[model samples]
Target: MADNSKARVRRLMPEDAAPYREIRLEALKLSSEAFGSSFEQEGSQPLDYFRETLAKTDVFGAFVEADLVGVAGFRRQAGTKQAHKGYLWGMYVRPVARGTGAGKSLVKAVLDHARERVELVQLAVVSDNEAAQRLYRSCGFVAYGHEVHSLKQGGRYYDELLMAVALTLPST
Candidate 1:
């Protein structure tokens, strides 16, 4: 296992597009069932598409020394009523960095960023992904609902568990 004790998390910039794209594509191809998007769909996109996405979304990367090992993204919900909520998406950690603390650090970074801006942070994990579910739960997320056949890939369906963490305390 890599020494992820030295792992650091930071918001990805436009200049980090190439590496981000590399890891993202790896994630989609290696764990196709974990995401709603497909490698085929995103792999065809140009580099500028990733650069623009980095410029727009709050994507965070975890680096052990100089190598990027993991990534997670957060985005504010659209519309007036949903403004108090934000979605956590596209979380991926390289296989080599799985047992290390990279995933937790990335999740913490997203939650910390979302703390000041939204009341709740939400995410959806494939129902069978126990490791990811435990990670989210350890970070204070609770499953609020479950969706059957939430994702379809290669003619198969995946159920998803909707989870969220409250960033703000309830008023007394």
Candidate 2:
């Protein structure tokens, strides 16, 4: 595995939606238990959906030598009562990019984006995914609760651990 220190992390633009869709499908197919959406469901969506999502959500990508290798997404809660919160969603690092700084860089990018507009950023991890749990914890996320049977794939139920990180404004 390549070390992630050299990876370039940046916010993805609308033009990058195609590659983002490709990698997202790859993630859903290979790591079904880790995400709430299924490959079948997302694959059937129109290209416009992906483009619109990319244009609106705070999605970040990690590139290694011009090849996109990882992705993370953040979106602020959309309501008057929930405006202070955001969600950390659709996090994935390509197998080849694992252990490289890609995962951490993507997370840092998401949290940095979240801090700009929300006071808390929340996410969920498959209860059994230790590596991902560790990654979130390392990013300062802490477990707050568990959602039993949060997702069902192939008739199997998967539990998800809810986690969140409080964002503090930088002191002037």
Candidate 3:
């Protein structure tokens, strides 16, 4: 659905496994350092796995006409002590759609979903990924810490900047 010439971000349905998997595998392959999951690990997963995940998590896809252009995922923490927290993950925008507002729309949709169910939302970005970090900051997420050796690839480690945003104002 187009809204005033803007691509609309919609939550993926179980039948969207094909397009979702296509974009996800592409993201993992094109920007391995930006995601925690490897292309090999996710690529081997069956179509049913994608469908199951779509059913479980609040994953949203940005579509330009009938083609899927971008995707992001959100999940709330489980368990009593941590149930108030949620996370934003797997954020990726197709290179062609980078400057077309798909990335920002995906993030804003995730934050809007998170605000409904959790008090805080968290996400981590590769330490040197300045563009992604800047996007998150513009959405009101602030860095709280940095984790060293967060992910390793080919014997090299990458640091991650941990960030979070409070969905609700502090109680007085």
Q: Which scores higher on lDDT, 1 or 2?
A: 1
In model 3, where is the ten-residue run with the lowest total lDDT?
1-10
Q: What is the lDDT of residue 120 in candidate 3?
A: 95
Residue 111 lDDT in candidate 2: 88
Q: Which stretches of candidate 1 lie over 4 Å from their true place?
A: 1-4, 169-172
Tens-digit per-residue lDDT, 1-172, candidate 3: 1223267899999999999999999999999988889999999999999999999889999989998999999999999999999999999989988767788889889988877788999999999999899888878899999999999998989999999999973465
Best by lDDT: 1
**Roughly what TM-score does model 2 have, to 2 decimal places?**
0.93
Weakest ten-residue segment in model 1 by summed lDDT: 1-10
TM-score versus the correct structure, for each prediction: 0.95, 0.93, 0.93
Candidate 2 runs further than 4 Å off: 1-4, 170-172
Residues 1-172 of candidate 2 have per-residue lDDT tens digits of 2334678999999899898999999999999889878899899987778889999888999999998999999988889999999999999999998887789989898888877788999999999999999888988999999999999988999999999999995655
What is the Å distance of residue 126 in model 2 from its true position? 0.4
TM-score of 3: 0.93
